[model samples]
Target chain A: MDSQSIATTPEELDRSVLPHAHEHPAFLRHHFEDVGQQREAASFGMWVFLLTEVMFFGGLFCAYLIFRNWYHPAFVAGSNTLDITLGTTNTAVLICSSFTMAMAVYSAEIRRRGQLILFLVLTIVLGSAFLGIKAVEYHQKYVDHHIPGLDFSIQEFVHPSNPKAIPLAPDMAEKTQLYFFLYFAMTGMHALHMIIGIALLFIMVARASKGAYTEGHVIPVENFGLYWHFVDIVWIFLFPLLYLISRYR
Target chain B: MTEKTQETHQDAEVHVVKPPVYLAIFLALLALTALTTGISFIDLGVFNAVIALAIACFKASLVVLFFMHLHYSSRLLKLTVAAGIFTFLLLISLTMTDYISRAWGMF
Candidate 1:
């Protein structure tokens, strides 16, 4: 019943040619049979990328687990030094971003362009808020000379400003540097992911404005939602491991 | 009476059904997050890591099942994803065995 079946004569074929000649976006490829196939491929690809991210973070976690067991006391002492309030706040912020991201994807699916844009912007705002808080926490650690580098100082641990502060063994205190190193490495990597996710979100917003996903081709939005949630899950793990692990002790 | 008819029947049978509401999943995730955070403040000794990871795993499963629509995906797709995760776990476990055994002086 379509025009393809009726395109027998040359004149008919010529008349149908101009409309069929309209090209999709340059980013869209030909190998995919349709928009659905393209979307599925994109989502699957993002999932695989996230799987690699897991392995990447898995290395840091393995290091933490091994070293935590080896130098349990030092690691626990180092964990105690972390500001739990900041980490928990960041976790909550990331969860809010994930919620917004899900809403963005849902809005796209339901063909609510304005809602999709609003949610995407909200997710970006929440993500930036997380990074801003993280920067402040890291800066506080720096001012306290807690950075695990050549400039790291153990004077505070050796001779505390408060008499009730636990005095660490000099050697154990040195080992705390390893803990902070792991902390910076792990959380820094996570923050890097957040930056990339936010950048991608901006790109998605631009594409969404062009009415790309408005017609119900919402695969990009959906895939980005997965990425956002995965990043959130990473932070959820990192928060407790770094901040809340030995707070009571 | 032919192969095409049999294939159509199988396709119908294998089709996935979507959930009526995603709000339940969202609420569950929020609850799990709060629960995990609250429990982390408690001194559970060695069980702390176990509990945290367990809750995280549960939350992740909920997200995958509902938000990602894995519950509605075909068997092949589900198996593929499971295989990917299984391989990652295998890598992590094998590598950790080496690292952990080093600490025990079994290296």
Candidate 2:
């Protein structure tokens, strides 16, 4: 790098500079106008990407609402089959993970590298715990034959083992399979996002421990925080829709 | 690897959220979760699903407004977020018209 080209620090790049004379961080791409513009563009792009993800999940949610309305009794029976204890625990776990992710972003903004590492680690742990509980829940579903297109048995819905269990006709109980299909499709999709988020968190934690996100280069951590929180929001809706659908009935 | 030399807020400002605010939001979310679970035991008639979804929307709004920092972000960013949600609502509402109308003997 020439002497003139080497002088473009973030401050220099932000100030008045004649064309290529401005300096920037090594991580800055050649296409960006400057650090600020790069950060803005990166964030904007992430939001657009997140919008697409929203629509992707929206399709599943739309199907859920339609089917639940059509087969309320079957849906209710299928919902009750879920272990609310584990569902609630998973919800709390995800909320905590979202909290840790926000704290990680805050630490990055403040340039607290140590705290950033700590927060990222905490977020990953919490996220993994949520997935662990979810696995247990899924395992129980497998044992009870609730997995649609698999060994899904309608016996539970048609003939309740519990006195308080909601009753459904055998035909309506067969519709419970549709409910389980949506349940797996929705929650499984959410879990897939969580798995991917945790994997990305590992990469961020490594870089954060090396003090990568501090010093005004927090765009990465900040963008990832948005994603982590989006996943949490999905679960926020999912818990109530799938686990708590008219349980009192 | 480039070293993080000096702290610089050269171009834009990053909001540093307080710890207490996050803790408060976390607690509120947990409490709401518990409330939803507790209320599920008492039949709210046809309003059960409505109340649960309302509570969920409330909790999600808190996370979006504060934790996500959309409150402090640029208007464009806020608009983008709003657009996404609006589109989702549109999808739901438009499709529901068909489902509900069919049940009304529209065919």
Candidate 3:
């Protein structure tokens, strides 16, 4: 390690010493060795943050698993009340949004400014649509008095309207509240993430329209795509666990 | 690694996933979603939940691998994701051991 051999100052560093100096775009941070290092560091940091998110959501999943096993019948009844059509529709909507987000990232990478903006806007619209459908589902729950701690009633569970449905004892019927509680907690958290993702999408679209991400600075767009996809992945698990698992049972 | 080598490596690593690939993955995910929903209505007994989760896992893998570009990502990022999932499984399994061994069906 010859200290004197390396250029000690920014001005001293030039194409003569660093042959690839011209490739260092202005957006590259000074502390990073190059664009690649900067991109990797940023991606690594984002993933670490997402890992913490995994743990956060994992706790909720663990609780749901234990309780669902303990009160299997209550869970089945509670889950059956959910509108499967809406649930499936929302899942498809979110999957489409993820597809649009991937296209947005691709557009940014290829430096197609118009396409980038278009896809970002599309993602935002689809995300909002997802939230709109979720609102309808929550409203249905409200109308049925299924919101835990608000105005919950177990009459439907106690004497189910479906002829083939198995009725629950009053005590078991009360356990349905726990199922609804987990449902609201998990889906509410997921919805909050979608709301945040949509809000960020607006900002990304604004910046993308200004040629921000298309000019060889695509890290922001790429990282946000990761986030949007992560949210979609959460829904992938969420759909089956909350809506699909107990349907046939 | 020299600056010149890093520049060349960066250029090599920037593999732009095409629109067709994204579309293919998207369609596959939607199909899997529909399949899982469909299967949930059939009373497969214990396997109903199992199949639903299996399909969900497959759907998530597609998003992660292609859409999220984990397939093209560096090993460091790949291991980071795997580690996160490993820890999550550990948490669930460890807790279950305690719960399952104690009171059995008492809950």
Candidate 4:
């Protein structure tokens, strides 16, 4: 929690704003009343940031909804091309990671240093496994010529290799590019957030190894838990919206 | 229950969520994921997408309430989250309404 104490210049932090002066820990910032107030304020700020993230991704979702409704067959064909096995596995992996992250926050609260380190490591591994599977899917898409730049082609949807898949007319197949575009845009944005989160996890690991958060200071762990769960929540929506599009006949 | 609530009232800083709570939420999420996937395999016409979205919303709520610990948080934080969702709905409804009402009378 106090790892960021170095982030702000000392002179700028007004100790007066934090009124609970009776036996406070060093990690409790001078600008907060107590650890409770500090934790609440930090979480409130985190939720605000998450709210911004909502609207940010909302634009992409809005586009997906309109385009999907407009081109139902193209959407269906395009969705069927997705590897359900990998998508389901990734969903399970992310859910498991969210579980581990919640445990990590619990470990931090209880001041269990070893469990904290272990859970954080597990989260990093599970998160990385998700990215590895996602990378495999992206590479497969690239090989299938589904990347939506000028190199993009609709042969897959136009003449699907899978007999079970609905075939799209060439023009409608071109519309499949729109579907793929939204797919990459949405999932790619999600992967970018995962990459950033993994990077942060590494930093947290290094700091936690040094007993940074095990000393009755859990704001950082708690706040980061909020963030990790938020990423999972986004995937919770994405799994159905992207992967399960009228998948039946 | 009264004693537990009183303890929390005094020590508001550290709220330790039991591991069982987390485990239960995790299982619920996994079960919902399975349900959504299984349901998608049936052709329910227009109901399919609606049901899928509804399930997704339910799973997201679990994550928000338990995993994110918003249930234990303050009212202002809850309102903030609600406002975000409201604005998102506003965006979706307004856009969908425009598109849906575009060529109204001809039908």
List model 1 lDDT by residue over A1-249, tens digit each: 011122223443345444555544333355654444555566667777778878888879878888887777678777877777777778777777777777777787777778888989999999999999999999989998899885999887776564645777898778889999999999998999999999999987876666656564566677778888888878877876787666553
- From the highest DockQ down, the ranking of the candidates is 3, 4, 2, 1
Best by DockQ: 3
Candidate number achieving the greatest TM-score relative to the actual structure: 3
lDDT of 1 by residue, B1-107 (tens): 46774554353232222223456776677787778778877878878878887887887787777666677664545776797789878987998887766657622
What CAPRI-style quality would you assign to candidate 2?
A: acceptable
Error of 2 at A230 (Å): 0.2
Model 4 per-residue lDDT tens digits across residues A75-179: 888888788889989999999999999999999888888999999999999999999999999999998888878588887787778878877789889888898
Against the native complex, each candidate's DockQ, computed on alpha carbons, is 0.33, 0.46, 0.67, 0.49
- The count of backbone overlaps in candidate 3 is 0
Pick out the ten consecutive residues of candidate 3 chain A with the lowest summed lDDT.
A1-10
Global Cα lDDT for candidate 3: 0.86
| Candidate 4 stretches greater than 4 Å from native | A1-3, A6-22, B1-13, B103-107
What residue runs in model 3 are displaced by over 4 Å at the alpha carbon?
A: A1-23, B1-12
lDDT per residue for candidate 2 within A15-83, as digits (tens), equals: 424345565665566676557666667677888888999899989999988888788888888888889
Better candidate number, 3 or 4, judged by lDDT: 3
Candidates sorted on lDDT, descending: 3, 4, 2, 1
RMSD of 2: 6.1
